[model samples]
Target: MKRQRAFFHTLRLPRFRRITLPLLLLLVFTATSYSLVGRQTATVPLPGLVMIDAGHGGYDPGVMSNGILEKDITLAIAKQLQAALQARGIPTAMTRDSDIDYADSGTKGSSSKRSDLNKRLELTEIQQATVFVSLHINNSTLATRGGAEVFYSEQNEGTAELAAAVQSELHKIPQMSKRDAKPGKYYLLRNQEIPSLIVECGYLNIADERARLNTADYQKKLAEAIANGLDSWLQKNK
Candidate 1:
């Protein structure tokens, strides 16, 4: 029994954590709150609810430029983000996964964007979601405009903070440039009660950025960055 206690005491020592077993464990659950031994003891934030909106779908190309569709990029990033979050054990729901359309008018797609967003809010209320993130792409006449932008609604200060958290992490990646978090009028951010953010991954007008956004590798990096941001925010909040 004393030997077991001595072993526990050794684990409690910081020096022991640098040893082989502990170091390997640290690699297994990188960035999680718990040290090497935390895998089973602590809960990963992934179990919490997050709504991932893939902007545009079906016939709606969203913001189209240079033959690239905003819908496609958005879905790609959203799905990638979903995979990243799930890897960390975060539960996520997608607003749309396929090339379908949800319009701002008419009976078929006519549900007011506001109403549709409000319905998402209702779902969050029921689901107790931790956050809301909408994926989008930017477009401008001049290719000079480039970089990722994060947007939050005016209502939730927490949402803005979360957006900033994500923006900060995204900037850490090698090629990504940081832009300020703007207050957007987007429906998902405005209508949802939970902390919400809209990520403008890049500008479609810029050939380099557009091409970068098209690659699976870049999309994976974006997803990882997003996951890191969410994880950081959750650690602070939780």
Candidate 2:
């Protein structure tokens, strides 16, 4: 009887030791992992919402040349831009998703245009956007003049930086013309309280540019470049 009791006691101690050691190790590992995860989460910055405005729609076709309508092109590029930004975890809102304008009922001529623009401006505040980007297609009498240009309002301190960032990325495109970001007295940019800029994707009067802008592939490239530029600016400013 004494021998049997001693044998059982020896086995019990070994079993207890084995279970207790592993449990303690597990607790330590779990605590370490949580600490690392917390640190990573705290270091990452949150991005702000961007307001994208497709320049013209509905009755307002903006500048048209070479069988291309400005309203159509703007909406296409805007949608692509929204997708690209969202894919990178950036929040975005569009002024108009369809071929429609914001003008109120019975509004006509210049009044309609003003009403439409005012409504678009109101969205920036409504969406609580940190930045505003207006997409447009340029037209010049000289057919030779082509390429994307970025314009910013001098009223806002950060507008120039945002424009420069986007302009730099657009310049990297093989088919895009290299142009410096400039200040503009545009209605949208002038009234914006936040950082606002207009990106003239390309000249519609230019044959080659018009053809490329009409294609889905080129529009995607433009959207991607704009997205990269916005991402770059956000990272630095955030």
Candidate 3:
């Protein structure tokens, strides 16, 4: 009885009351904020703002053939895509605006590669992007395989729709022809919690395709196609 009375007396004190009430309210607010963030992260079919990742940079040249480098093409396309999206008043973010990689510039081996990828992931989260599109050039043992291919992860529910929308637009490009969307196991796509897809602009192994990809006019066409596709998808989603 004495201890209970003492406890009640302490609560009645001005100092204790002032400190305790504020602390309790703060704890409640923090918990509520954390719960809301968790729910947002788990929700599917993200909408608003797109993220563009230009794959391979710095020491990584990616696929190289016939004096052409994959990294250059990827960056070119990504920049074009960013511009196209911005022109239409759509918000967008790019992983890289230059030839350098996100990883340490002078470091050796795969550590830098890993660091670069981790940075890209962090940016994607910070932006809270609706979808992630990684731009890259394709390569194969068979030189005959040419044309654009859009690949998406099955884990994200909206990725299939995103892939279809982009793929359909890519096909309209005279260079891309009628290539279809494919399922892929790419690290960026698989790890991304949002709707994600990879756009292989063209196969570098093919002679004519390589020549075309190297041209500024063809790159612009490719960018326009992807932009149109994104616009279509956004319309349907909205």
By TM-score, the candidates rank as: 2, 3, 1
Q: Judge candidate 1 against the unseen true structure and give its global Cα lDDT, from 0 to 1.
A: 0.69
| lDDT of candidate 1 over 66-144, digit per residue (tens) | 7788889998998899888767666676665566543334433445444445544554454446688888899988658
Compared with the true structure, model 1 gives a TM-score of 0.73
Residue lDDT tens for model 2, 1-238: 1111000000011111234677757654653211221221111112367788998887789999866899999999999998888777777778777787877778789888898898888756755577899999999886576889999999887778888999999998887878889999999988999889899999988888999999999999999999999888877877
Candidate 1, number of clashes: 7
Sorted on lDDT, best first, the list reads 2, 3, 1
- Give Cα-based local distance difference scores for all models: 0.69, 0.78, 0.74
* Prediction 2 global C-alpha lDDT: 0.78
Q: For each predicted model, how many residue pairs clash, with residues at least 3 apart or on different chains?
A: 7, 0, 0
The regions of model 1 sitting more than 4 angstroms off are: 1-47, 103-126
Which 10-residue window of candidate 3 scores lowest in summed lDDT?
A: 2-11
Q: Give the TM-score (vs. native) of candidate 3.
A: 0.77
lDDT tens digits, residues 6-72, model 3?
0000001111123467776765465421122222222221245778888887668999998799999
Off by over 4 Å in 3: 1-47, 104-108
* lDDT top scorer: 2
lDDT of 1 at 102: 38
